[model samples]
Target: MTKEFFTATPVKQVFDRIVEFVPVGTEKVPTAETCGRILATDVVAQTHLPGFARSTMDGYAVRAAATFGASESSPAYLEITDTVQMGMAAQAPVGNGQAAGIATGGMLPEGADAVVMLEHAAKLDETALEVYKSVAPGANVVAADEDVAAGQKMLAAGSRIRPQEMGLMAALGMETIRVFKKPVIGIISTGDELVEIGQTPVPGQIRDVNTYSLAGTVGQAGGIARTYGIVADRFDALRSTCTRALSETDMLLISGGSSVGTRDLTLEVIESLPDSQILFHGIPIRPGKPTILAKIGQKALWGLPGQIASAMVVFDRIVARFVGHISGNALSYRQHDRITAELTRNLSSVQGRTDYVRARIVEDQGRFYAEPIPGPSGLIRTLVEADGLIEIDMNTEGLEKGETVFVTLLR
Candidate 1:
């Protein structure tokens, strides 16, 4: 039977297919060990962060009206009535024309709305304070809920846990957090020309690159990478390996399986599996146009290109999205991955294909510029020199010099 091939579909359409793969199970992890995990539940603040209004500077806490018009040339004088020590409650409200000495992080005294920095004020006598600068109400002091307010949602579901999030949760008395279980991603490399990394390849063979590269990429995406050894370019070899990998891992990546010479063999092998269906055969993205996406049940199977550069591009730009999504932190890449930078040189692109140009970032002054690294996708040097990838839209013909573009940073 002649099957209808999935032709070049838009990248947006491909992303819409993400609902086909379900995220893994959720588990409760200690807040200290939750870094890099995807949150399965919203983290709410139970109590006010810091829990008290505190001075941010070591100086005097006084009513703003008491220091009005105070400056280096013309100063204001107030009585130094009391001191608030660190780790102690503030007491003895400052009355009119009165100031209370306080250190950084000391609780603010009642009736005091501002603090004068120590550098901006001095004590002329034991009871007299000379203010050289004026402060407004709410100045130099952080409110009780400045970091996070009680009952507020600090982190939403699908948010990735970073070190900062761990610290914030700990401050709110959260000892444990609910997060998605880390995904297990299986990797396979297919080709008769491939040899083990330990063995020096003979004249016709080359060391396997995709297995290591793809595994590292998977690990960086917060998935546990389980690599299966290389499979030769044969239907039976690929079918058996694919079967085992699919059963063993939550997702599978087959490097070089979708290349020109082995495309049909790989497709046939995938079709033989139970409940297998090809999602797409191609995308309009450059360097990865021949990539294939298939599925058996809820597990996603990616047939990445054979070329080193093309395979890496497809995995990083496209497959990484699925991995991140199944981990429950789908927004991690969408929100934080791309950075805007000015293009250093003009780049021409085909109108129909969305081109991804690898580039080095140049920072001159406080501004950043993307310098395109021109080379074939197969060249390893080009990938190494690139700090990020510049995407040219399918409709756009070219990019002009000094044009600002969003570049997806490499992991």
Candidate 2:
């Protein structure tokens, strides 16, 4: 059956459709294993962080008023009453006209509201201290709940756990946390002229690079990848594999056979599935214009171009964005690591299509410049040599030499 081709859909519309089909489920994991995982529930602090007033420097704990009118020219003298030890409570209260020697991170004694650094004060005798500078109350001291207050929400639901987040959880005495289970993505590569990586390709045949590269991208996006191996470009063969993969994985990525040709059987196979709906067959973007987004029941099914570079770009712009959202990664698109760089040369593009130009970022004299990597979309080495991608908007005709642009970092 021949199908009529529709106009390419906007990238934002495709993303909006995928958001409606995101799965909802969660699992419990140890705090140590929560890195890169998304929190299913809010993490609230059980007790105040630091729980006590602590010294931020090695100094003397004293009443702020006692140091008034003190300076290097004429210092105020006070008797040393006690020493506050590290990891221990203050032994005695700091009385008026007295100071206690305290180490960094030591608990402040009662009646002491400020800390005077040791460099600003000198020991007059074994028991006497001379203050050379004045300090105000609460100076150099962290309040009991300065970092986090009791009952405060430390992390909201949908937060992706990072190293700092793990440390915060540990500080809150959390050994285990509830996090969303990693989505399992089934990767299938299809082409009549493809061979496994270990085998050398004949004149017309090439290695199956899309599966491995797409699998790595899936992992980087916090999804578990299950490769279904390469399948021949046949209707029945592709349909059988797609059926099993969709049943076994949360999402299925079929790389190759997306364009219109005698061997392009992906659309046929996907349409043959029971209760299948095609969200979009093409995107209005360069290099990845033939990409497809579909839905089978609640699971997402994607058909990426056969070329390695195009597949990677589609995954980065579309698949990765969907994966991050479903995984509850809290970071917005603007929050992703990106930097502005001056273009080394001119780059031309059509007005109706957005373009992702691979570029190598070079730093010289404290300025960053983006040198475009010139190669066809099929060449994987071009992507390898580039550090990031510079995007050309749909309405812009081209970017001139030395024009400032934002480069989306490739991890």
Question: Tens-digit lDDT track for model 1 on 35-56?
Answer: 9899999988889989999999
lDDT of each: 0.88, 0.89
lDDT of 2: 0.89
lDDT for each residue of candidate 2 in 145-255, tens digit (9 for 90 to 100) = 999999999899887888999999999999999998888899999988999999999999999999999999999988999999999978888999999998899889999
The count of backbone overlaps in candidate 2 is 0
Error of 2 at 240 (Å): 1.4
Question: What number of clashing residue pairs does each candidate have, in the order they appear?
Answer: 0, 0
TM, every model: 0.87, 0.95
CA RMSD per model (angstroms): 3.6, 2.4
- TM accuracy, model 2: 0.95
